[model samples]
Target: MTLDFSVVTDVWQSLVYGTLGTLFLAVAGMIIATIIGVLGVAILRTHMVIPSFLVTAFVEVIRNTPFLVQIYFIFFALPLAGVRLNPTMTAVLALGLNGGAYAIEIIRGGVESIPKGQTEAGLALGLHNHEVFRMIVLKPALRAIYPSLSSQFILLTLTTAICTSISAYELTSVGQRIEAETFRSFETYFTLTGIYLVISMVTMWTLAAIGRRAFNYPQR
Candidate 1:
């Protein structure tokens, strides 16, 4: 059957609003994840015993599980534990925690990739553990794994589509609503695909720029 572009066009405003929701949720979750990931990695790297093991276990469980199941756990399972969250908050927390787990591994790899000599050199220079990590190690680590981190964030954005199943009214969720109302599934989804593509591309580009500037890689 032929597609009706007009139906999709008519729904553009609603889709834009929904896309904004998707972007907001993704960006907010990513910010939280970044904080958690960095702190989690720091804890693993520095702590001597129990905290490190617990963080590692948490990371492993989050990384190994299916994200859909995690979301469901946050939304449905939590209510069973006498904790209730709105769908949006549930989606944000679940996505953030899941992404943070993956990011911890990515960032820890960067941290570990640093030369042993670098740490020794920092120590010899009278730099303490925190200073060594903060100054001598952190920038190089970020520069080393920034590309990987960016890819993960892009993947996280795409995964926001899954949030619709929880009735979060994200871009995909709104597009599904429009499709049901207009009976123009092809047009609705195709337009949605384009919007997602643009958003992902823009987000990647902006993040890459920030990464480069913040890390200040060597110029050719």
Candidate 2:
């Protein structure tokens, strides 16, 4: 019944390695999701009815489904269709797609919040449609939604723990292995909980600093 943290000392390296794996998965997924989000927004904004419909459908399907199920499908089902992927890749793809669905809506809201006159003004200035989007709209929209986007990414980082379900070898998976070895379930999980909190706080603070640098401006 005595509490012992000596087990942690023994397994600290493994836990640290696992945390780095978790960070890698989260960061890779975030990059993929951001790319997908930008593309999804572009597709949705297009005048083409079919592409817009398809993008909307993709967003709806991903947003409505449970992330675990999506991961299972990516890990379990895709291989059956001859589209095999490694556990890490599967985890990244699943997490990215899941996050992308939410990001689309977030980015779309940012885009929509800008006054229509801004778009018109950009077009009137002899800019191409893409240039107008990039120069006149995208930056401001991103600045407006940067906080929400950062929060989503933080959630994405936490969601990396679920990657362990697919044996993706993230922090939670390593913690489970350590717990199995040490039989110190309480101490192991408590430490993991604390580590996750630290990760979350660090991520938030880092994003806030990036936001200040990227989005700071004089408000009228």
Candidate 3:
């Protein structure tokens, strides 16, 4: 079998566009996931039984269910409830909700690691609830969990490929179009593998830099 890379050369522009699309989805989804995670933790800390129980239930359901099914439900079933969204929106929403579940647990562990005295100290200093959360609990917890969150974000970035099932304009959807035209199955997928690796590497580097800036702590 003659492996031809000329197929990749011909579809290079499409691939580039797809990479940009994937990056957009990944970054946007990461932002949404982070917001959900932080907010979820805040609600759980309130110790209000009903709200805490609901948040716990949301996390548990998302964590237990398959991501593919979650995406499908958001894209298809949500419309029946009048929540119509384009594939891109649906994919971003699903990715955020899915990642947020894990983020909640990761961030919660970080929070739990901190001694309760710090929180009590902050309260005694006359800090408001949100202030204590933002200043005392959240920042350090995020620092502690940064590596895990970075890994999860990278996985979320790769998961963008799955958005192709809904015709989202991401890397995999673009690759499928190119593959259909080129019929170089092995070559096409081989090229895609390389591209995905590069994207993951770049994402990892970016996350590392952000962590260094945001979570820099003196090593004891």
Whose lDDT is greatest here? Answer: 3
lDDT (10s digit) by residue, model 2, range 69-185: 999999899989999999999999998998999999999999999899999999998999999887678889999999999999999999999989999989999999989988999
- Once all C-alphas are superposed, what RMSD does model 3 give against the true structure? 1.1
Better of 1 and 2 by lDDT: 2
Local accuracy by lDDT, each model:
0.89, 0.91, 0.92
lDDT of 1: 0.89
Global fold similarity of model 1 (TM-score): 0.95
Cα deviation of 72, candidate 2, in Å: 0.5
TM-score, each model? Answer: 0.95, 0.97, 0.97
lDDT of 2 at 121: 90
Query: Residue 7's C-alpha lDDT in candidate 1?
Result: 89
Q: Which of candidates 1 and 3 is the stronger one according to lDDT?
A: 3
TM-score of 3: 0.97
Off by over 4 Å in 3: 217-220
Error of 2 at 98 (Å): 0.7
**Colliding pairs, model 2:** none
